[model samples]
Target: MAEKKFRSGFVAIIGRPNVGKSSIMNKLVGEKVAIVSNKPQTTRTKIMGVVNGEDWQIVFLDTPGLHKPRTKLGEYMMKQASEAREGVDAVLCVVDGQHIGPGDRAVMEDVARMNCPKFLAVNKVDVTTPEGLMPQLQQLATIGFDEIVAVSALRGDNMDKLKDLLSGAMPEGPKYFPDDMITDQPERLICAEIIREKALLNLREEIPHGVGVEMLAITKLSDKLTEIHANVYCERASHKSIIIGKQGAMLQRIGSQARYDIERLLDTKVLLKLWVKVREDWRNRTGDLRAQGYED
Candidate 1:
C-alpha cells in the first residue's frame, strides 16, 4: 500500500469574550471539547480539539477570552491564551460579525505579534445582515490577515470552507493525534466542564462567571452505570447558598441537567452527585485554582 503524505499542525483561535470562540472550536472539531456559556470567561484554559481528515489534521486551540486580569485565576487564563499562540502553525482571530471594540483591537494586536499565518474568522454572520457583516469584513482588512473566512459556527455556515482554509495551512507532517481522537482533554475534565456548563446555564449571570466545577471522583461501578462525585465551588458562602438554592431546588436542577449530558457523553447511566462548596477567594488563590484545573 502506498502511504499518503499527511499535514497536521496547531491552529489557535483568538478572540474577546462572547465572540463564539468555544462555539467555533467545537464546531470545527465536531465535538464539545470546550464548554459554551453566554457569560464571559467560560473557557479558562487552553483546550485543543483535534480534527482529522483523510489527508490532514487540524488541531484547534480554544483559548480563554482575552481580558485584563483581575485575580490569579484570571491571570492564569490570560497567560494560557498568550502561550497558546507561541508555537501554533496558524492563528484564527475569530470575531463577532457586529461589535468590534477595544477588546477586539487588543486581541488583534496580540495575535499580530505571533509571527504565524493569521486568518480572520468572522463569526455569527447568520445573525447579521449583509449590510451589518460588510463593515466587519471591511474593518478587518486594515488588520492584515492572510485570509478572511466568514462563518456561522452556530449554524455551520461556510464552516467547510473555513476548515479547508485551515487544512490548507497545515504543513506536511505526521498525525499528532489518533484518528478517533477529537480532543486531547481528559474525560474527567470534560465531566467537570459539563457540570460547570449546566451551572452556568441555570445560575444567574452574576454567579456564572464566579463558578467552577471540580470532579472529585468518577468510577465505573458496572458496565452500564458510572458514578460521579463533584463539587461546585464559588467565592463566598452566600454564593454557595444561592447555588444550593431555596430548599436545595437549584442544586437538584443543576445535578439533574448535568447528569443527562454526562450520561450522553459516557453512553451509560450516571449517578451524579453535586455538592456546593464555598472556597473563599478561590479564584485568587493558587491552591484553589489548581484544584479546579486552571493551572498550567
Candidate 2:
C-alpha cells in the first residue's frame, strides 16, 4: 500500500505509438481491455482499466499513442491522448528502451504542461541491453520526471515494483470502482475493438489503417451465448476486396479469430457476422468518423 489509508486515483498511460502502453495497462489490470498490435496507432481512443489492490484502486486510462495528425481520426486520437492527462492524479510515460526517438519526445511534449506528477516507465527491458537502456534513461532524465522504472510489459518483469511506485504516487482518496470491476467500457465498443484487433493482426499494413469496425447488432440468444452483427468499413472498393479476400477466406479467418476473443471477453459463446462496406475516405470525413464512434 502507498499509505496506511486507502489510495485511489486516475493514471493516464501515455506514450508514442506501439511502445507497449496498452500492454502495460492490460497486464496490470489482468485482462485485455485494450487492443494491442505491432502496428502504430492501433489504439484509437482512451480506454479505462481499473486495478484493485488490497487497500488501493488505480484507474488506468490507456490513451491512444501520440502520432502526427493525418486526418480527422488522427486528430481525434491525439486530442484524446492529451485530454487524458487533464485532472488526473499521475501521468505514466512509457518508452521503448530499445527504440527511443522523436516520436517519444513528441509524446512528452504533449504532456509537458500538465500539473500532475509524471512517472517515466522504460518498457521492453527483457530485450534491451544495458548499453541500449542507459542512453534512453539518460536522455529521459533531461526531461524532468518525478520517478522512473525499468519494466517489461510483455514478460511481467518488475510489474510489482511498478505497481508499488504508482500506488505510492497517488493521494489518499475514495475508491472509484468495486474490487471485482475490471473495466467500464461498453460491450459494443469492446466488441468493435476485438474485431479491429483481428484485422490489424491479419491484414496488410495499408489495409489496417483504412479499416474500422462498427457493431450493428448484438443480442443474447441464451444465457450462455451471444450473437453479434458487425460491419468493417474501408475507404475504397479495392480495400474492401482485400479485406474480404478471395472466396472470403481472409474474412472468415478474421471472423474466426475475433469470435474466439470476443467469446472469452463476454464469457459466452459468440456468433459474430461481419460485412465489408466502402465508405470512401471515412477516416477524413467528420460524419463518418462520428458515426463510427470516433467522436472528436
Candidate 3:
C-alpha cells in the first residue's frame, strides 16, 4: 500500500474595501472567524481561518483591504495587507462583480507585483448581471491571473471549485495547525472583535471607525459561565455619547447582541460588561494604537 499524501499551505485573501473577503473566509471555514460588515475596511488586521480536509489543510489569511492611507491607522492596515502577501502559497484576489473600478485595479496591480500563485474570485455574482460582468472579467484577465472564478461568497456559489483550485495550488507539506482547530485568534481577541462588530452593525458611519474594543479582563467564574469586562474606546467624547446613546439604550443593545454571539461562539454563558471611553486622536497616536493591538 502507498502512503497517503498530505498537503498544506498558506493562502492570502486580498482585495479592495468591502469586496466580501471576510465573508468568503467565513464561508470557507463554515464559521465566523473574521468580523463581517457592509462597512469598508471592517478588517484591520490579518485574521487566520483554517480549513481542514481529508488530505489537505488550508490556512486562509484574511487581510485588511488595500487602499490609499489617510491616517496612521490606515497606513498600518495597508502595510499589514502587503506583509500578508509575502511567502503565501496562493493569493486569492477578490473583486466585486457589480463594478470594477480604480480600487480593484490598484489591488490587482499590487498582487501582480507579488511572485506567487494568484487566483481571481469575482465575488457577489448573485447581485450582478452577465452583461455587467464581462468588462470586469476582461479587465481582470488583462492582469494575467492564473485562474479566475466567479463566486458569491454569501450564497456559496462555485466555492467548491475555488477550494479545488486552491487545493491543487498548495504544495505537499505537513499540516501547520491541528485538524480540530478552526482559527489562530485567541478567544479573548475574538470576544473583543465580536463586541466591536456589534458596535459597527448598530452605530452609524464614522462612529464605528472611531471606536475600538479592548478586553479589560476575562475570568472563568465556573464551568458554565465566564465574566468578560471590555471597554469600547472612541476617539472623541461625542463619539462616546453616540455609543452610549440616551440613558445607555444604545450600549445595552450593543451589549446584548455581542453577549449572545459570544455565548454562541464559546458555547458557554457569558457575562459581558461593556463600557465606553474616550481616547482623543487614538488613530494617530502610536501609543494608543499599539495599546489597541494596531501595529506601529
Ranking by lDDT: 3, 2, 1
- Cα displacement (Å) at residue 123, model 2: 1.0
Per-model lDDT: 0.88, 0.89, 0.89
- How far does residue 212 in candidate 3 sit from its true spot (Å)? 0.4
Give TM-scores for every candidate, taking all chains together and pairing residue i with residue i.
0.96, 0.95, 0.96
Query: Residue-wise lDDT of candidate 2 within 175-223, one digit each (tens)?
Result: 9888878887888999999999999999986888999988889999999
Residue 6 of model 3 has an lDDT of 92
lDDT for model 1 comes to: 0.88
| Candidate 3 Cα outliers beyond 4 Å, as residue runs | none
RMSD of 1: 1.4
Candidate 1 vs 2: which has more TM-score: 1
Question: Candidate 2 — which pairs collide?
Answer: none
Per-candidate clash tally? 0, 0, 0
Among all windows of 10 consecutive residues in model 3, the one with the lowest summed lDDT is: 287-296
What does candidate 3's lDDT look like per residue over 1-296, in tens digits? 99989989999999998999999999999999999998888898899999988899999999998878888899999888878888899999998998788878888887877787899999999999888888778767878789999999989999899889998889999989887799988898899899989999999978888888888899989988999999899988888888999999999999999999999988889998998999887788887777667864
